[model samples]
Target: MADELTTRSALQLRDLVAHGEVSAEEVARAHLERVAATDDQLKAFVTVTDDAALAHARDIDRRRAAEEPVGALAGVPLALKDVLCTKGVRTTCGSRILQTYRPPYDAGVVERLRDADVVVLGKANCDEFAMGSSCENSAFFPTRNPWDLDRVPGGSSGGSVAAVAGFQAPLGVGTDTGGSIRQPAALCGLVGVKPTYGAVSRYGLIAFASSLDQAGPIARSVTDAAHLLAAIAGPDPRDSTSIPKPLPDVLAGLDDGVSGLRIGVVAEFMAEGMSDGVRAMVEASVERLAGLGAEIVEVSLPHAGYGLAAYYLIAPSEASSNLSRYDGVRYGLRVDGATTEAMMAATREAGFGSEVKRRIMIGTYALSAGYYDAYYAQAQRVRTLIARDFAAAFETCDVLVGPTSPTVAFPLGELTADPLAMYANDVYAVPASLAGLPAMSLPVGLGEAGMPVGFQIMAPLLRDDLMLRAARALEAEVGFDAMPRGPNALAGAAI
Candidate 1:
């Protein structure tokens, strides 16, 4: 029953609960059992809320018994990336500094989830402060890919994607600063959406890069992601930057196929460095869309090569500023040393992992007096050029298409020694993020690594529904969810 329940989509489970085919308590219990049976190897969760989930499930059962109104997501169990706060839950952003820190209130998204009657499973693991492209930076433990445990699950949302793909949960939330969500979604073969900047409120998500950070959903299918987005998206007075637009009928838009729409296949994507397998898959995706009656247009974004360099500078600079509050004074782990100031320095030095410190130092240097103009300011201007490039490309087409990443999932330790190479992993994703465009990752097919390869679909800012509609069409046409290996293949392996 647990395996059967875990395999179902969140919408399917919701319907079952609503129709009394299964009770909320049973669904919640089944998820908890799956988590217990699998999480030790996956390390997908930073914390699991067994008690709170069951209690919420009981409350749902009681409400249903009284015939009270329940939200569409009533009793659906979902996991949140630890980057989002939850009241009293140890919302460690996979960093040692915040290992013991618990927030006093729920994040805006968490409140929305509660209102939707979704049960909180726990906080998923993430790269420290959402910095690394892989989950390896997590001070707790790395989240391995469910498909191949020895390989990485693209991150900083690795845990959330792994949790969903590993059948720990049906849906989860993830943030994309520079392809953090989409890259991982592509790697994990799940549908990951990074809505237009300001489309979803960032009130409770720990700041990564203020301008680039936006939260959305990660689920097994395009429809599931759309449903989760509908539940959490809307204006939140708490986040001043949040767009106050009315939610789109995302679920209703799922049936809109890719007929007579113009799809842009960015020429830069097919340039040198893209693996043959990835190119073949993306080309196949274009053919599939063409078969669906969509026109394929070749578009150029000349300055896209600068996206990675600009993103590293800007993201780290903002991270340096946002992380200044953690001086071991107000919150998080503190060190016991000679003096107050010394202890603060020691705490940070000892608590933060090597990668986190490296980025912070890089960011601090970029923002420092002499280097500010050359690094930070220059990066911002380059950002402007990239945005302009997107504007020009969008003029010719309704959506942009490309392989989500250059290659498929690699072994866990493959790129650890080369930080620049690891950062380059997001080459395809950072461009959309820098432009603040709405982009989603839909699995196209398996690549040479026997793991999923996702095709990224980018729509103009605030055109999230069109992006979803296009992705749903492609997803339906190229169904890639069929697992390559049996569950027993991963039986004793840690993901």
Candidate 2:
């Protein structure tokens, strides 16, 4: 029963809890035990709030007993990416500088989760300040992929997706700036959603790239991802960037078949450079979608090749500005120096990791006086072109399809020395983010190294429901089995 509960989808667990078939406490404890048993090997969690999770579970049980109205995800266990502030809980963003820091208020998503009665297992690990493509950049420790213990789980939401994929949690909340959520979800063989930018509130979320960063859901199935997304997505007064309109009903049309829907396959994404296995798997998935009655059309994003270069400049520039608040004089780490300037320098030098520092330097240089127009401004112009590309492509199709990542999860330390290789992992994913459109990664099949290959579905801004509908249709055709077979294979077997 415990194992069954651990492996169940969030919606399934919620239904079971709602029907009184299982108490919320029992469900929470089952997942807690799974985390305790598997997280040591997976290293997905930065903190495990077992006591708090149980306490929340007990409250949910009381509510159910009293016949009080419970939210859609009443008893679901969730893993929150460490980047979202969780009130009294430590929100590290996987950086040592804020290791001991705890926010006085919960992020908008956290508040929504609490309101929905979802029990947070703990804060999941991520890249330092949400900055890297691999979990190796985490200041605490790298989160290993559950499919192969020696390979990396993608980042900066590595721990969030890892937790769900490893059966430690039924669902997770992760932020996506440059495919942080989708890339990791792809590598982990889970469903990851990046809602249209500003559709989900960013208030209380530790800023990475303020304009680009948006929080969304990670789950084992499309239905589960839709349920979680509904709970946390909506307008928030605290976030100026948040859209004031009501969120579309993501689940209402989720099961709607994609009979006449046109799916645009980006011509450039299929050109070359990825492993043959990955390309073949993605093509097979596309064929499957076509087989399911959806029309497949070839669409070209002429400037797609420039997405990586533009994203690096825009995201890092925003990150550079947003991270400026962490000076020694403020709340995070402080190192003594002869003067204030030296102290701030020492603090940042000691607090940031190599990847974070690299981005900061590049961003600082891009935004510097003489180079601003040459770099930052030009990058912004390129961003506009990318968005325009998506706009033009959407006119010919209901949604776009592509491989989530060019390659599957690589072995640990494989790309550590090559930053460009790491950045290339987000090549296909960055274009949607740059356009502020809704996109999701659904596990379609296994590729090279027997790791998961993700099929990306993207919809125009505010049309998340359309994207999810297409994903659900494709998901049924793909029939992906997300069971991993590494150190936690026994745990999964028990499930």
Candidate 3:
């Protein structure tokens, strides 16, 4: 029974805990054990809070026993990406610089999770300061894909996806600056949502491209993702960017199928450079959705081709500004020197990873005196064009669909030496981010090596429900199994 608990979905576990059929502590233990059993190989978590989780579970159990009202996700364990600040818990944004810094207050999303009675098992790993397409850039360690240990689990949100896919947790929260959440979900065979910007509050999230970063859910099923999203989606005074508009229940019309909905297939997303295996898988999913009564049409996003170049400039520029606070004087790793300036320089040189420094340099240059108009301003203009492209496409389509990642999970270290190759992974996933639209990656089928392929679904601004409805519809038809088969690291995890 304990081993079987790990296979259950978040909703299933929620029901079991809420009904008192199983104590919350028991469920927490089952997942903690799974993490202990597999984390050494997968490197999914930077810190495992077994003691904290068990205590949280006991509190939930006590509430249930006392017949007190509980939140929507009572006693469910979740893997929170380390980028979000958690009160008293070390919030290492997968970097050594802030490795020891613990926020005095919980992030807005963390507050929501606690209110929802979610148990956070640990701090999931990520690319340092959420800056890479692959998890290999983490200062602590790289997260290995559960599908094949030799391969990479897609970037910054890889740890969150790894936990759910490896059965270490049934739910997780990850941020998408570019495709951090959806890209990782694609490689790991899970459902990942990048909610429309402002749909979820960004307060207390360690800044990383503040304009683009959004916290969303990673789960094995569409409904599970909706439940998680609802718990954290709403206006918060703490986050000025949070939507002031009242949020509708995210799960209200979730299961309603996509019949009569027009799903636009982005032509730019299907262009050359997509692997044959991935192309075939996405093409087949479009056919299946058509059979399910969704109107399929090919739409062109001509400006989308420039999304990559613009994102690189905008994200890094914001990062350069946000990261300037880490200059030795503030809490975190500090290296002393004779002068304050020397100390700050030495500290940053020692604390930050190579990728972070690279981005900082790029961003600093783009924002420099002479280059501002030519680079950053131009990039912002390009961003506007990309948003216009999406707006034009949405006029005739209910939701846009395409391959999330150009290819299935690539082997670890294959593209590490060539950074440009890595940047290309987000080609299909970036335009939606640039447009501030609600987007998701749903497991469609296996591609090369029997690994998972994710079908991307995007909806108009503030119409997250529409995208989810389309995803649920196609998900019902494709029915991809998400169990990992990567050697003995987490083999038979679902069992």
The lDDT values for all models are 0.88, 0.91, 0.91
Model 2: residues with Cα > 4 Å off, grouped in runs: 486-495
Per-residue CA lDDT of candidate 3, range 1-495, in tens?
A: 777899999999999997788999999999999999889888999999999999999999998888988889998999999999988999999999998999999999999999999999999999999988789999999998999888888898999999999999999999999999999999999999999999898999999899899999999999999999989999998899999985566688888887898889999888887888899999999999999988999999999999999999999999999999999885898999999999999999999998899999999999999999988899999989999999999899999999999889888889888878889999988889988999999999888888889999999898998888888888999888888864533586743
User: Clash pairs of candidate 3?
Assistant: none
Against the true structure, candidate 1 reaches a TM-score of: 0.97
TM-score against truth, every candidate? 0.97, 0.98, 0.98
Clashing pairs in 1: none
- lDDT, candidate 3, at 213: 94
> Which of candidates 1 and 3 reaches a greater TM-score?
3
Worst 10 residues of 2 by lDDT: 486-495
In candidate 2, how many Å is residue 322 off?
1.0
Candidate 3 total steric clashes? 0
* Tens-digit per-residue lDDT, 1-495, candidate 2: 766798788888999999899999999989988888888889999999999999999999998899888877998999999999988888899998898998999999999999899999999999999998888999999998989878898998999989998988989999999999999999999999999999999999999998899999999999999989999999999999999997799989999889999999999989987788889989998999889899999999999899999999999998888888888786889999999999989999999999999999999999998999999899899989989999999999999998899999998899999999899999999999999999999999899878898989999999999999999998998889988965434256233
Give the per-residue lDDT digits (tens) of candidate 1, residues 1-495. Answer: 544787788999999999998999999888888889888777899899999999999999999999998887998889899999899889899999999999998889899899999888989989999988889999989998888887888899999988888887889899999998998888888899999999888998989899999998999889888989999988998998888876666777677898989999999877877788888999999999999999999999998999999999999999988987788988998887789889889889988888888888999999998999999999999989999999998898999999899988888989989999999898999999999899999899988767788899999988889899999898889977634353422452112
Residue 180 miss distance in model 1 (angstroms): 1.1
| Residue 278 shift from truth in candidate 1, angstroms | 1.0
Model 2, CA-based lDDT: 0.91
